[model samples]
Target: MSILNSWWRALVALIFPPHCPVCDLPLGDEKGPICSPCLASAPLTSDWALRNDTPCDRLSVKGCEVRVVAMLKFHKAPQWRHLIHQFKYHSRWRLAREVGRLYGGKMAGSLFLSDVDWVIPMPLHPLRRMWRGYNQSEELARGIAEQTGLKVETKSVVRVHYTRSQVWRTREERFKNVQDAFRVAHPERLAGCHLLLVDDVLTTGSTMRTCIQAIVDAVPDCRISVAVLADAGGGS
Candidate 1:
């Protein structure tokens, strides 16, 4: 990190005080986005084991495993939502990298992220990317790449359309909302590589599924898995 970056980080920490993502309390020099208590309390689907099964098999697409190794569950934990909301809707770009670094560090020794060749973030619509100064997913990908030493290809996957928000939608509505929303921009790099798809949160799995499908269609031999900071809601 450069001096300018360090200064900027210090300024951010002073302003936000490094609150726990799950509790919204000061972290007290713990060197993370969340405190130890919140990290222990956060829900994780795969702890000691790595399940290759997709969260929603019905939405499974070819060429990607689609396993969601999420750190925290979304609902019933208002603080996680608030933290994610702050990064997404608010102009808290610092929080995205912090959250990503925390999650990526947790995944360092985990077998779930062991074989990834690339870390690819789910792209936002161009309009949304323009409206928002930064892409939360890209920030997470950058942080993961920094820790994992894996390449992050930001231009490989792109959102072809802008759909309505999935926050309050039902399962069916959510599936309809993200259909054909993403397309692969560079298939050559992904053709024979194992990629890990990253996102801020996993709710219905519709958006991730669509993005995975697009990549598989474009690159027939590409292997993929999914990871997120939070996983909210139940799925079959």
Candidate 2:
């Protein structure tokens, strides 16, 4: 609010104005990214929050329980896939933090999320991370951590090996592909802690399930919850 700080902010804004991530409309009111209409109508998939059973239950491993939640329905009529595509393939890195903030804001008052002890992002293989210059899941987790006052344990888990892209695989193939792909690097960090496992999108829940299985097996007493910006909501 200082005069110099205000002037600097104005200069920055003039240099880089905010725009909507979905429809590419210019933003107003210094509101940051996303316009009002898209914010209100963008295909949010909060259904899992209200449901008792979730996809995580299907990946049940002994000594651990997992739950899933998502912010938007990726394949529904309105279509959230476009946004995710922009984020993933187009280097729309800005979208990750903005979308993460939106999700954190939405869940801010939720009784379920208020007690989360850590935000853990899904990891990309080292090669992929190097090629992309950043991990989208890590970016999203940082934003969520900032808003929710939860610690983000970026290195607590890791991708131990690279696997084929799950895009064209059948559900069974997808599950098998990611199996044993992840390993917890710092299992002690997650011991007995409540973790919110984060990803940019949840397709068949295979990837998250695989990651959750490894973490729970490593830290057998940790409580795990899943949160994604989008979910495909299909069953095998």
Best by lDDT: 2
Clashes of each: 0, 2
lDDT of 2 at 164: 74
lDDT of each: 0.77, 0.77
lDDT tens digits, residue span 1-236, model 1 = 69999999889878977666557777897866668887777665454156555444634675355556666756646666878888898787878987787677767766766778889888999899889988999999888777767789888888988997888899889888888998888898787987888888777777787788888888889777777787665664
**Top of the candidates by TM-score:** 2
CA deviation > 4 Å runs, candidate 2: 1-19, 24-31, 47-55, 75-77
Q: Which ten contiguous residues of candidate 2 have the minimum total lDDT?
A: 47-56
lDDT accuracy of residue 169 in candidate 2: 96
Q: Which pairs of residues clash in candidate 2, taking residues 3 or more apart in a chain or in different chains?
A: 45-71, 45-72
Question: How many clashing residue pairs, candidate 1?
Answer: 0
How many steric clashes does model 2 contain? 2
Candidate 2: residue 73 Cα off by (Å)? 2.5
Per-residue alpha-carbon lDDT of candidate 2 for residues 54-152, written as tens digits (9 for 90 to 100):
435554567766677778765653445666777788786777887888788777757667668889889999999988878888888888877777888
Candidate 2 lDDT at 210 equals 85
Error of 1 at 2 (Å): 10
lDDT of 2 at 103: 82
